[model samples]
Target: MIQKGSTLPEADFSQLKNGEMTNPKTNDLFGGKRVLLFAVPGAFTPTCSHAHLPGYVALADKIKAKGIDSIVCLAVNDAFVMDAWGKAHNADAIEMIGDGSAEFTKAIGLDMDTSVFGGIRSLRYAMIVNDCRVEMLNIEDPGRFEVSDAETMLKAL
Candidate 1:
């Protein structure tokens, strides 16, 4: 499992923007920034589609109020899928990423054997990564959603 104070996975994924792509590395992604990253099992699913994303949405201003530089929503999905979900949800304040291959998830040891639901899934978790090292983490129990909420991370921040 991923722990607090660990460097994020060094993986690169294609980010689509304006029909173009840029494959950015993990190091560059969190370089010198205070980032709030939360992961859900799937994009556009029940809990994530509703409560989880909304928590970030509702408190977008509040989260930023704490001096955080960015709030990101990641999933074990692809960049295209992630982008689509972002548009659908109107997550203008949250950065959405699709880790379709779970490269980042596995590198950080956050992968769960949830093939029972079809392939790997990310544990519901949130982390405050400062300039790449995790400062704090909140991991939720499987099939339960609580710890990773934006408010919890906000308090930790």
Candidate 2:
């Protein structure tokens, strides 16, 4: 598992931003910015759609006021699904990035095997990254959403 103080690994992510496809590398997103990044097992999953992403969307202004440069919602789904999910939630304040191949998830050691639910997915997690180095990491246990919600992260900030 990646620990606080570890720099994020290099990876490419696909995102549909402003109705255009964009490919951003790890450094492009985190190299010189304070980023609030949260990951879901899949895009549009029940809890994720109902709570996780919405929490961030609702609190995005406050979070950015706390010095966060960007609020990113990551998932192990394709860019198209992630974009649609973000649109559905009206998450204009959040950047929904897709890790379709789970490369970034596995690199952080947070990947899980979900069998029929999905071949591979990320465990629910939230982290504060500053200039590519992790400052805080909250990784949820299986089927749990305790530590990684936006309210908790806001309080932590």
RMSDs, each prediction?
1.4, 0.7
Question: What tens-digit string does per-residue lDDT give for candidate 2 at 8-62?
Answer: 9999999987788998999998999999999999988899999999999999999
lDDT by residue for model 1 over 20-64, one digit each (tens)? 666677766688998888899998889999889888988889998
Write down the lDDT of every candidate, Cα atoms only.
Answer: 0.83, 0.94
Model 2 weakest lDDT span, ten residues long:
16-25
TM-score result, candidate 2: 0.98
The number of clashing residue pairs in model 2 is: 0
Local error of candidate 2 at residue 146 (angstroms)? 0.8
Misplaced by over 4 Å in model 1 are none
- TM-scores, all candidates, are 0.93, 0.98
Top-lDDT candidate index: 2
